[model samples]
Target: MTVTPPPSRSAGRVATAVERASSALGRLRRGRLLHPAGRSFVGETVIWGTPGPPSGVALLDQPGRYRTTVRLSKGTPTPGSWPDVLGLALRLHHDDGRPFDLLVSSSGAAPGLRNLPLPRRRFTGTYSTITCYRAGRRRLWLAVLADPDSVDLGRSLATAVAATRTDTPRLVLAVASAVGPWRLVGQVSLGAQLSAEEDAALAFDPVRNLPPELRVAGPLAWLRDQTYRGSRRARGATAQSGGSTATTV
Candidate 1:
């Protein structure tokens, strides 16, 4: 079957991100997401992931409805190189008048939502990308989004990241679903402009924040990375032994 590959994200990353975002949203909702009215947040968590082919390391999860791809390619393609695989798990839930749900949450960041820094400004209504350097082991030189005159992008992002208590996250959810209609209740919506009160409240949400124990890349993530590296080493060994295996994501 020919996969359309929505948003350039490969299969693996999409599932992981969606799962994380969904779970986090669920925990935070507490029956608060669904409202009595028809209006709702532009985007919110709705469905969890469905299973896919049982591949190595649970990378390619298939919800059938979602479009996923691999983020990291085999070789170091480019500096700002968006991986062949990424995480694309969003649906255009609403498009009545305004395009509000520009970015939504995913599931893998569960219990923790994937957030992209929104430019705080009186925007002229133009989409723009910002080049920034992340200071961490990954030290990723990635693109961020912001407004023309929004100088507080960094601070806002820092506050949000600090609110969630997570390290620099690579993928920010651009769209997602909610348990019910958040707009109806006039409650918190995933894509709504967060107020200071809402930010403060979410900063401490048990589900929104990751436990200190799971703070850093846990053993599983480490294992996945190490195992990936080890596989490369093993491949090298095989190459030396005059045997070969073609790796594919």
Candidate 2:
């Protein structure tokens, strides 16, 4: 049997430093360091199963529908008409009632560029996982593409909020290998808007909330977990001052 070695002491030290810095920033901001301001909505996710090769994730291999909560935000607080990295976070419930969180950000759709975040003027652009997820022996990436039938969303956060007020926003959920084309696997339809308090109280951690078949591995996952732990701890400490401490899913 093949065994993976543990991270080196130097790597561990760097991860620790990253956790500490992230914790401090989370405390300073009293919320998310990136994507502080966002809009949340009640949504539904429908899986159609991929038409191409099996993704190895049962959720995407079989057809299913689930209730979901979605959050859309900008990575950097850019003003009106300015381009900024957009974020899309989805929270879904597993069959056994555990939360499955999936977070993606505006990024390239091509092979070499998929991991790179790209500033987008509109919320209708593509959003990528940025990191690959392990599905058995294979690694795959996920993405969300705006449905062509959906209304055209503008550049500003306010515009997106306002547009969703009147129109139901729809997105296509797709998956692919590192250098493969995206294959449609599901659809996401967002409905009613969530209150500011509700939005603020929502916290997403993909590292902890994923399914067994689809694992987030590697040193990057370790770093991500630490960062998320630090942020959650810092925010929990000051939860009473702002949003509720209760995490929805």
Q: Can you tell me which runs of candidate 1 are displaced by over 4 Å?
A: 1-190, 204-249
lDDT of 1: 0.21
What lDDT tens digits, residue by residue, belong to model 2 across residues 101-188? 8889999888888899999888898899998889899999999988999876678767777877898778999999989999999998
lDDT of each: 0.21, 0.79
Clashes of each: 40, 0
The candidate maximizing TM-score is 2
Q: Which window of 10 residues has the lowest lDDT sum in candidate 2?
A: 238-247
Top candidate when judged by lDDT against the true structure:
2
| Model 2 pairs in collision | none
TM-score of each: 0.18, 0.89
Model 1, 1-249: lDDT tens per residue?
A: 111223444645654554445435434543112110011111232222222322111111212111111111112111222221121111222123211111111112211222222222211121211111112232111111222332221222223223223322222221112221111101111232233332212111111112121111223232222332233232232111110011110
How much does each candidate deviate from the true structure in C-alpha RMSD?
Answer: 21.6, 4.1
Q: Which ten contiguous residues of candidate 1 have the minimum total lDDT?
A: 180-189
